[model samples]
Target: EAGVTQFPSHSVIEKGQTVTLRCDPISGHDNLYWYRRVMGKEIKFLLHFVKESKQDESGMPNNRFLAERTGGTYSTLKVQPAELEDSGVYFCASSQRGLARSYNSPLHFGNGTRLTVT
Candidate 1:
C-alpha cells in the first residue's frame, strides 16, 4: 500500500496570501484526517474525512481554512489569507476501514507540509 504523501514539503507565503496543501492517502483507504502542530503547541486535529463526506471538522481554526476530499480520493487543505500563527507542520493520515476502528492501528502520517507565513 502506498503511504500518505504530501506536496511542497515546505512552503513560505506572505500574510494575506492563499496556500493549498495536498494529501494522497493509501489506495482503498476510507479514512483521512488532517492535523498540525504549531510552534510550542501539541499536535492538533483539524478535520476528518470519511470518503467524500467530512465526518468532522470541529478542529478547523477559522473561516479562512477550508478542507475537502473531492471524489473520496485525494484530499486538500487550503488556508486563505494565511496568518503568522499558521506557520507550522501540517500532517495527513489515513487507514483502512477495518483498521480505522482499531486503536492499535494508529494513523499513518505523511512527512508533513511545513508552512511559514510572514
Candidate 2:
C-alpha cells in the first residue's frame, strides 16, 4: 500500500501570504491525521479525519488554519495570512482501521511538508 505523501517538501512565504499543503494517504485507509512540530515544540495533533468526515479538530491552532478531506481520500491543510510562528514541519499519516487498533500499526508519516513563513 502506498503510504502518505506530502507536496512541496518545503515552502517559503511572506508573513501575510496564503499557503496550502497537500497530503495523500494510503489507499483504502479510512483514517487520516495531520500533525505538526513548530520549532522546538513537541509534535502536536492538528486534526483527524475518519474518511471524509472530520472526527476531531480541537487541536487546530487558530481560525487561519483549515483542514479538509474530500471524498474520504486525500486531504489538504491551508494556512491563510501566514505568520512567522507558522514555520514548521507538517506530517500526514494514515492506517487501516482494524489494524490501526494495535499499537504496532503506527501512523505512517510523510517526510513532512516544511513551511517557512518569513
Candidate 3:
C-alpha cells in the first residue's frame, strides 16, 4: 500500500497570488485531514474530511482558504490571494474510516507542501 502523496513539494508565490496544494491519500482510507505549521510553530489542524463531506474546519485561518475532497478520493487546498502569514508546510494525513476518532489510530502523513509567500 502506498502512503499519502502531496504535489509540488515546494511553492513560492507573491502575497496576492493564488496557490493550490493537492494531496492523494492512501487507498481505502476514509478520513483525510489538512494540517500546517507556519514560521516554525507547532503543526495545527486545518480541517477534516470524511469521504466527500467536511467534518471540521475550525482551524482554517480565513475565508481565503478553501478545502475540497471530491469523490472522496483526493483532496485539494486552495489559498486565494495568499498572504505572507500563510507560508508554511502543509501536511496531509489519512486513516481508516472509524479509526480517525480513536486515539490509537495511526495517521499516515505525506511529505508536506512547503509554501513561501513573499
Candidate 4:
C-alpha cells in the first residue's frame, strides 16, 4: 500500500563525482520508472523496469547514467562523473502491472532526489 519512495532527497557534488540515488516502489507493483528534470526543462523519462527486466531505456541521456531494479524490487540510478548539466530532481514512479502494461493508469511518484553537480 505504500507509495514510491526515494532516498537522499537532495545531493550536492562537484562535477565528476559519483552519486547514487535509490527508489522503492509500492508492494505488488511490477512497473518501475525513472525520470528527471534538468534546470527548468520538462521532466523526461530515463528508464523503465518491468519486474527485474528493463522494459525501456530510450530516454536515458548518456553512458554516465545507469539504472537498475534488481530482483524486481527497489531501484537505483547512478551518475558517474556527474556534470553540472546533470543537476536536477530525479523522480521515481511505479504502477500496477496490468494498468502499467496497458498504460491505463497513472503512475505514482516519489518526492524525487535532487542532485546538484557543480
Best by lDDT: 3
**Candidate 3 C-alpha lDDT tens digits along 2-118:** 999999899999999999999999998889999999875899999999999999999999999999999999999999989999999999999986643665668999999999999
Pairing residues by index, what is the TM-score of model 2?
0.92
Ranking by lDDT: 3, 1, 4, 2
Q: Where is the poorest 10-residue window by lDDT in model 3?
A: 96-105
**TM-score for every candidate vs. truth?**
0.93, 0.92, 0.94, 0.94
Q: Kindly list the per-residue Cα lDDT of model 1 for residues 1-118, writing each as its tens digit.
A: 6789999799999999999999999988889999999988999999999899999999999999999999999999999989999999999999777743665556888999999999
Between prediction 2 and prediction 4, which has the larger TM-score?
4
Clashing pairs in 3: none
**Candidate 4: segments with Cα more than 4 A from true spot:** none
Spell out the clash pairs found in candidate 1: none
- Residue range 3-118, candidate 2, lDDT tens digits: 67899799999999999999999898788999999888899999999899998999899999999998999999999989998899999998767743654566888889999999
| Candidate 4 per-residue C-alpha lDDT over 43-103 given as tens digits, one digit per residue, 9 for 90 to 100 | 9989999999999999999999999888999999999989989999999999888843577
Backbone clashes in model 4, listed as residue pairs:
none
